[model samples]
Target chain A: MKTTAALSRLFAGIQADLDLVDKTFQERATSGLDILNTASMHAISSPGKRLRTALTLLSGKLNTYRFQKLLLLSVAFEMTHLATLIHDDIIDEASTRRGHPTVNALWGDKISILLGDYYFAKTAGLIADIEDPRIDHLFSDTVATVCEGTILEIMTSGNADLSQETYFEKIKNKTACLFAACSKGGAIISGASPEEIERLHAYGQHLGIAFQIIDDILDYTQDQSTIGKPAGNDLRQGMVTLPLIYALEDESQNGYRQQVQSLLTQTTHKEEDITAIVGWVTRGNGVKKSLLDAHAHGNKAREALYHFPPSPDRDVLDELIDFVLSRNK
Target chain B: MKTTAALSRLFAGIQADLDLVDKTFQERATSGLDILNTASMHAISSPGKRLRTALTLLSGKLNTYRFQKLLLLSVAFEMTHLATLIHDDIIDEASTRRGHPTVNALWGDKISILLGDYYFAKTAGLIADIEDPRIDHLFSDTVATVCEGTILEIMTSGNADLSQETYFEKIKNKTACLFAACSKGGAIISGASPEEIERLHAYGQHLGIAFQIIDDILDYTQDQSTIGKPAGNDLRQGMVTLPLIYALEDESQNGYRQQVQSLLTQTTHKEEDITAIVGWVTRGNGVKKSLLDAHAHGNKAREALYHFPPSPDRDVLDELIDFVLSRNK
Candidate 1:
């Protein structure tokens, strides 16, 4: 939680502009229908770190760019992220987000689904008005990647034999693809050199993958109240996140593999089963192995930012790398 | 059933190009995820009249244009239309479409949701490469409208007091907006005169509104086998379409209103109630009034196209105006 304050401090230079993106997003999401407006408001009104939007703003400082268009693109990326979350809640049947009831919980799954669609459309509408074909391509391709990754995750759910390669592919699609697009798109709109764009894109990729790993890790380590989501909820729901994947692969933890496998196949789990699984996952070297992976990715993300000479923007990005990996430090 | 041949004939000049749109769209909607690929292939493979794609191709012939780009844009429009249908089925909890099992039925709501999103992203990817901001603007704006419209429809599903004005607004957003964008976008891409673009857009608007009216009326009038959907489906689901709105307003049908209203408010409806409502809708002036409304809009659609000098494309469009309003003729 202290890392959030650190993350906020990193955005101090561009706080006002980030707020503008927030204001613009809220103001634009209204559909003029009462129910839709209510649902849309509920979705955007929820507290999010807005990390992706911040990345866009921070990246824009690296070069000369149209400030308003950059903000719009940033909002576009945030909206797409929000869109995915709305659908994700439905897919997960999640009851809360940021400690507030989700759109699916407040409204029904039907309205939630449509509101998710609305956000995706709203994102496209934002970028479609921008003249940069590269940004358009990046945003749409990222959308494809996100959806494809999610569908793959859904398809592979409950399989204990899922590989590390497949897990990386899934998380990259569901999380890193959009992050890569955010940084790359910001660079493109800023008229950065092609090489710089590629570097930032790679930076965002590593950062996003590491970020998701921390998220899954925190699901096991953090309190349910702190995360605003049920702890080990993924395991109970038959989802195979990185932590569980590592536990399954650890020879040292093989004693509990059959127990975890049996729990995975169970459609209904006792609360005790979840507790036992979490205990084993934490006690094993799985969490350590996962953290080691995140550290490596965090290092790679920092290496990608080496292209930019020291500036406030690059410094802020470096701080974000620390923020993402700060769980250990 | 008879209207099918006439609608196809309306695309006579662009039959081959329309086929190319179909082939291109089918080839492109695949996401390489086996489940998504199967679902998408199922969606595109199901027999659709492909009227929206035809409209784009026909509208392009109003002036000389970049032929392949126009075809691609047509495919883009069709894909967007299909994306909306996929989401709509989930919202409706529909089991079948066009006499075939829907993606939702085959896979589940979760996969259906992602596949629908995949199609939307695919459409954006197609237009993002087109090098035209107008096409991008049209595509995204239409997406927003379709979603907002559907959300509004979902919110108002059980309300018996829905107004005719609201009904038209809903249909315009849900259906006409995409149709309007298709024609207008095709004209923009083809470099048609502003007047021609406006005329075609208005034509599409009127045509789409009438098309939806016919769809509602067919629910009351057509056989289950002919329409591929259950009769009185909208009424059973508590949807008050144009015919129902007209029936409720009819002075001669005053007695049925109380009974109909009661039935609507019930969460689970009896088939007898659906039968009674459908009988009243057809036997009363409801279907007549709805058909009369369709005819008026159909006439207006035809009038918009009169601004164009007669050509094979123009003739085909004129025939479409008839196809939309035709029930028996």
Candidate 2:
């Protein structure tokens, strides 16, 4: 009951931080043009965890450098995250996101793409406004790293032979790198010591890995309503996440392999096929095992923060670590 | 004869500078990955005037900064330009660029999109390497403005009611802002005075506007072999460029507007319609008048540079002004 209450409190705090970032996004994109205004608002108003912004703010606070620059930097990271999401939807051919029709689904691919570009540009502009050379370099480098990671993901998609090492690298580039950047950049902007910056970066890296692993596990475990899309969608797309990796471990399961291959060969997948695979993965304990691994990562992430000065902010950071490993939503 | 010789000399110098930028682009993108090497080489091997890089180098030279920073900055701007072109081809559904199959046409839209992203990230990396706050800010601002301009263009497409003022603003953002940034940033990096930076920026602005106006005119007048794309293709897509703007001046040409409407109404466009419109626009001297306007703007661009001290580099700058206005191929 105490842990539940703590989780609730953490959720509320994150919600408030995200709301502030959304408000800032609104003010910055207030062009008089109607289409621009509508598109900008629609894109920003979507539900997101704002995890990147949280990492930025928490890291800055933990380093004892909470300031306007940190907030601006946080906003920049969130904008980049949002921009990438918008573009990713188009690339993934996803019809829905966050329990709503995607921007491409609503307005067509062209506007979705151009609007994504606009946000990327806006993010860069925001970072430019921060005006510290070290921060500027870090932000640009992070943006570049994120893009490279995305490209790596695109390259490896649907390749069944993709190794675990490459998958880790891809995830590091696509997801964890930005999280790492958020923490590292926040520390740099706040003028944290080099040691503190390194610690925060490590913390963010492990947290991101754990966060993505949980996401992959949830795809096979969560309800469709909670997942915001169909179950086993990633597997359908031939994205072999950790649970699938575990499922593929038994070379003697020829029947299972045949069933999976048959589904892969189908022109259009049926829900029953997806459900069967989900059931098999669940019965095999793949999901539960993956979750345990995620917890291990989360623990390591918290351990990385041990060198930081003890404070409430640090405590909140620890809570965040726990939240990643425990959250169901 | 003297004028022709002067023009030839200027062209030769510009070509040499373009070769240098191309070589630099090739060197920086030499990743061991075969796909990266192939894509980078394919993009850089295409023939372009390298106007943005030239502007960067020339402006830096004008301000007497003989450092490697300008070269790196020039490469960064050119990479960004190429990245946008890759994305633009996808957005425009263009099959050819520079008389060769576009990246999207040669590979696929998916690959093209990823490649464009790779270059965008690469440019950001280059900027980070420069490690200068002011240049970083300028580059980031230029990128944002370009994206905003692109969004505006997408929103206004096929809308005949779009005002000329809005069109100018869009072009200025999409095209002229980067050009202006190149000159202003180059001068600033070279430690030029405020007045000199402003003068160079004005020069870039006027030159960019004139450059685009000529480009728009060529879309109506030039042969496919020369312009490397079908003439009147923009009009076929319902884009209102300067020549089309002037052609629509007479109310009696309501028929022309109706023809445009009819063309757009079709499920598929016929080449005959494109050919007919191209003929009409050419005979009407719309292209000639547009070129004359380009010349007027080019003269204004030259005037902006009059405030600077007289040097041989200034002569080269003056020559470039006339060259951009008169170039046919």
Candidate 3:
């Protein structure tokens, strides 16, 4: 398990390129409209881990590095992720993200919806500027998949009947698919062969699944301040994530399934009820089982990395898998 | 002004191709998921006037008509329009559009948001399939401009002090830009000369402005049964459109401006208050003034069309300008 400092240092090889991506991201977010510029600037001010950006840069390095094209691709993917998050916050009615007020919380749903859309438009423009048909197709299909994944999540909300297969499907659509695109897109722009592109794509998919599983687990185990959101937030929203799915399947836990069903169907979740469910999931082997599944994915991601010769960028990606597994938030 | 039957006959030459566009639109709306397919199908089912489709087809006809490429472009533009309408309903909190329940009204805002995004993704994928960089840039820029226009409209919603220049800017961004893209896209695909493309772009832009001006006018003058939505609908939402703008500017109207100012600042608009304001605007030169402005743009559109040699498609486009000016709904 890497410490936060160690995790931050993992990307030392691509740190400069990642910094350039951040700069480009901020520049791309600027708009001619005062309100749009301000809101968009605020939206990108609190940056994420930039894991996708790193994946893109690192994957590009695996073949022939095209720094300029990779930078634009990285920015586009990051913008796409940001757009989805703004819209997601609207659906979740989340007031804050990463300890900062959400666009939805600050500007209202209408503004947030427009801002998310603005980011999407900006992303499309950037992809078009890249002018690669394959990248264009990959990006378009990935975004569509992300939307489908979100739709699937909304449709399956409150169903304790959600299966492991369906859970995998949802995460793949919502999270892993974009990760795959980042890697594959990087590979394509760097002129990597098709087989190599597929390998990186596989690598990103497994890493993304591991990342989302950890996120779901942290939702149960972490407190509000740590995760920057309420614990059991997904459960409160009636989202049947992997841990809850496993927890409910454990019939040995004294009618716990009925408790979950009741909680899922509740009109409004009381805080204590959410706490109790979180405890049940954590106390049972749900978090541990989810962790094991994440580790299995992490191993697959590592195996994908082994297909390429060892390089500094590959080491950072390998360490990223560990970071995904071990991070508390 | 052409009769309804005559207007329907305007696109007779391209009717078969337009039918194919509708078929493509329907096929593209389908998804593997039942809920998405159902919601998306419903969204596209209540089709608005396919004026954009006609613009694309007619512009293509002015050059070497590439029906296949133009068909895809038309469908993409139509889907883009559908996607915007779905999101617009969310912002407006609108229940019915085109005498049918909006996706936002039936499926809720969350699903509607995702479905809109799914359509956008589908649009992007279709554009990528066309593999034309110029088209790619045009489509991306057009979508972004639409978002900017929508944001501008929301920002200026309650401000009765919004300038006519700004109003023109808003409509151009929100409506005319896409129309320009439709015509320009058609011309580009059909291998039109640069000068011819510019003329078509200009034609579409002016026509779109005229079209939206008529739409705004209809919102003020038409009834719920006529327009499929309530009259003064924009004003109810605090949208200061052309007629209202002109009425507010009419200082000689003996305190009518005060009535409008007071109404604009009201927290909740009463039905009768809206009706009274509508009557004031109609009685004054507001609607008439707005109609003159529509005609001015309509003339400019006609001028752009006259640059091209007389052809069957060109004649249909010429009638289309009259259709834009005279349409009640």
RMSD of each: 1.8, 3.2, 1.7
Per-prediction fnat:
0.80, 0.45, 0.72
TM-score of 3: 0.97
Question: Candidate 3, A103: how far from true, in Å?
Answer: 0.2
lDDT of 1 by residue, B120-224 (tens): 888888998788877777887888888888877876777778899999999999998988888888888889988999999999999999999999899899867
> Deviation in angstroms for A17 in model 2?
6.3
Q: State the number of backbone clashes in model 2.
A: 0
What lDDT would each prediction earn against the true structure? 0.84, 0.76, 0.88
Once model 3 is optimally superposed onto the true structure by TM-score, how far is the C-alpha of residue B200 displaced, in angstroms? 1.3
Q: Is the docking of candidate 3 incorrect, acceptable, medium or high quality?
A: high
Best by DockQ: 3
* Cα lDDT of model 1 by residue, A115-139, tens digit: 8888888888788767788888888
Please identify which of the two predictions, 1 or 3, would achieve the higher lDDT against the true structure: 3
lDDT of 3 by residue, A107-126 (tens): 99998888888888888889
Query: What TM-score, to 2 decimals, does candidate 2 have?
Result: 0.92
In terms of docking quality, model 2 is acceptable
